[model samples]
Target: MQQTEEHHSYARATWQVVEPYHGAVYFSPEAHARYEELGADNRAGYFASRGAALGPASAELVIGTFYNFNPDLVHRALPAAWQAASPQRFLAARLAGIDATLHRVLGPEIGSAEMLRAAELAQQAARTALRHPQGRPLFAAHAALPWPDEPHLVLWHAQSLLREFRGDGHVAALLAAGLDGIEALVTHAATGAIAAEALRTSRGWSPEQWTQAVQRLCERGWLEQGPDLALTPYGRERRQAIERTTDELADLPYAVLGQASCAELRRLARPFSLALARELLPWAVDRLAAVAD
Candidate 1:
């Protein structure tokens, strides 16, 4: 226990030096209390992407993604806020509203009771968040931490959990590849084919590390060694699945969520979807800027 404590002490110092914003959020009294009640094991209210937080920007995006990612949790955590117009909600309600609206505007017409309400709330939030002058700095601060080299930690984690829950081996394998960085390379190639050798040098991967990534994809038959090789039919399908999700998220922007007042726009979800798309594209750009090795 003494040794473990020492390691955490060291980690805290290192984290603060490199990622100070995290220190502020993690040490917040309310955040610690919330995590304690939620429990470390189940990790409710805790984020897979950025862990727990309190500030509005982090709260809105991270908390919003939580509910947006898992519809079932909507009722469990913020039922009153999303389900009805009563006074009871937080970051999750506003985010969920955005997610539901984006989906409706893009796909599917079979709306759930909660979904219809979600659409309404998104528009109200997006417009208000965008219009507020003072809301700019506060909204920008909600931004995520620097993404790792593979920009797929949360995406891969959520997909992996979903596969485990539904027992989907095919996708489980694909998500595994994503986390390991093998999948992202091939996907990036099919889209535009970034020069792998140059990318490796810039990312500072060892020759072996780069080779192994290629080898992993090769073993799965998604890639092969050749003068001008490319992905297979099976590989395209898996990559397509990932691209589709990104395409969906690309439709919403964070700024709209930042300054928007959920109370004022309890029913304007549809128009909000377009505004959100613009926000999401820029947000993704920001995260990719800090991707780690």
Candidate 2:
């Protein structure tokens, strides 16, 4: 296997392997139910639970940190979400939900020795991320939270910190590239990784707004002027550059882990991540399979 110390590839690989395990908290039915009991609907639950780490942050703060969702959508969820549940309550519910979900999805493996080892390595990486909070708001906010005791929960929390660390960097890269939220989604859609309509709907963008963003991309010569949203060659290169920058910014924690430990963490985490993806995020299965290769 290629070592993480070789270059940026290790950082990206680590992210891909662990993402499903960390991200499963969002899609878990147990999490949704907990939020629902607090009087937060799905949208409110999603924004509030994720943003609760920021300590009742405003809609604008969420929009800035989230960096790709519609402002109006964020506005609809905030303050109201806080009113339904305090940040502390939201955070507690989030942890409880994660506990229940992991137990359900991972079963006996949650307490396995391999899990303890993965948690140790992941927490080490997260500590490295903690040292470099500098401009990473979401990551810093999460880093302030107390660490959980269970191996599975520790692994989840550490990966959450690392994911947000990368996410904060990704947002910085997007801003540096001069791509606004809608424009970023437009170009992402043009790459055909996901359907354009799905991206628009998930981000709470209107059809007209989606069309306008497409027009803006076309004006920038980043997209073809046809019915389909296809990237021009230049557009592809620009997109690749943005990803490269994100990877560069995200490499620090893995770099601290060194090649052997990074490889070990990936090896230890892969099966658990794959299990979570199979249970909670079917779309990620093929991508995780490719990484396993």
Candidate 3:
């Protein structure tokens, strides 16, 4: 086995794309918001545990890879097949399905340099030198890839592999709003209720701003629209946990931004001449708990 720590491979065929372990690292603005909320609630631990693992949907990807499922399965399956095939047939089968399939992971054409590179990385990581039902294969490979899209195949495959290595099972019932309308509209009542209260007591926002925001979310199906705004079941589910995330994080000490809500806080308060002063610095960590000092 070539230990990456001792001898790194720069060959394109040797590496794969990578994503961060925690789902919060999805790294979108919304994801950043979620991370902030979770951090404030002292829930960084939730991510700490899964730091380099796959996201919530990892299981499905795993089962798919093992079973040769999904549209791209054949291409994925082919390289591994070649690896295990007899030496005589290896080269002949090397480019199997190269022309027949359009792989989203590898792009529409398998003939591309990128596609070949991916096949090589996956082969080196899991297939090449594979010993059938028994021994752990040596000559392994590794790569840090980008985050997979929701329901992504390669991402799922990578996650499954990680879980097996660690003997960890990624299971949880945290509610996820499909954020699509097919879901029941009634779930968010509680969260909407919370939002409504927040809005009512909200100091800077105008009725129109709050109402417009709520209405926009309602139209987008983030919350249920009604005579009085409230969360749908989905919203309820997320709200319950998101708020808990804040409290969980609050165990650490943070000076409340006096009265500043999240919106009012921003990174690098460079405009404030007193930002260097301990007392007047406007920054707050994610939560009252989880202080870095």
Candidate 4:
């Protein structure tokens, strides 16, 4: 139990440092500039640049994992973007986007240097961590990809890969325990990151679809019936178990870092994450708070 808790703490801290990059990339001017150069708009550019790193994967591959954007949104973006530019071109655009965003947000200073150093430490740790069992398809594919030469880019890509590694594992764990995508999302909504209504709207699930999911969970004794939509005791236990499993799966990389090294990575990365929250992208902070909750 204690080991699990320790792993959870390290995983949470690591995520805090890197999570901003995942969301802020969509909002950054640098990312926009790179997208424009690629002859794609923000939505298509985002879908292409990020998806390109995975190779010319199908929309089903993308929608099932990686992105939380509605399936319709992704379908509209892909092949169109691919037709406009090859995956290699988009991959280059993706790196350029990250570079521009980080530079614009962090600027040239000790701050940028520290973030790069943190990325190096994280990449080293993740390299050690990925030696463990990973069952998720997306993570497996990403883990086999080449590492970037630049420390900052290495950090972003490393962290991104690690995040996906854990996410893919979590999805596997969720499925093993019998929660489908909508059920998983509904359970997550119980955490209050975004309202239930917002989750339904954002994911483009119809009201009937959302209601049916809730009913299915209720039938399984995971959630209570009717308007309130609260989790039963079983529901809470199941949710916690899924989270615990995910943390355990995510632990090896941090374990390779050891307690002291994990602490140092957190120390180095925390201020930069905080600066990102305060100076440039408060939405990242808000999202972090939701995830932490």
By TM-score, the best candidate is: 2
Please, what are the lDDT tens digits per residue for candidate 2 over residues 148-194? 98999999999999999999999998998899999999988888887
lDDT of 3 by residue, 1-293 (tens): 32232122111101111211112122223333333333311122112212212222132333332221222322333333323323223211211111111132233333444333333333323222122212111101112223233222332333323322212110111122232111222233334322434323322234564566567667765576677656666566665564343232221111121112111211111111121121221222112112111
Better of 1 and 4 by TM-score: 4
Instruction: List the candidate numbers ranked by lDDT, top first.
Output: 2, 4, 1, 3
Off by over 4 Å in 4: 1-3, 67-70, 110-113, 132-134, 279-293
How accurate locally is residue 102 in candidate 3, as Cα lDDT from 0 to 100? 19
TM-score of 2: 0.96
Q: lDDT of candidate 3?
A: 0.28
Alpha-carbon lDDT, every model? 0.34, 0.90, 0.28, 0.73
Q: What does candidate 1 score on TM?
A: 0.30
Model 4: per-residue Cα lDDT over 175-210, one tens digit each: 777987778888888765557887777666788888
- Colliding pairs, model 4: none
Candidate 2, residue 196: the lDDT equals: 87
After aligning candidate 4 to the native by TM-score, how far in Å is the CA of 155 from where it should be? 2.0
Number of backbone collisions per candidate:
17, 0, 29, 0
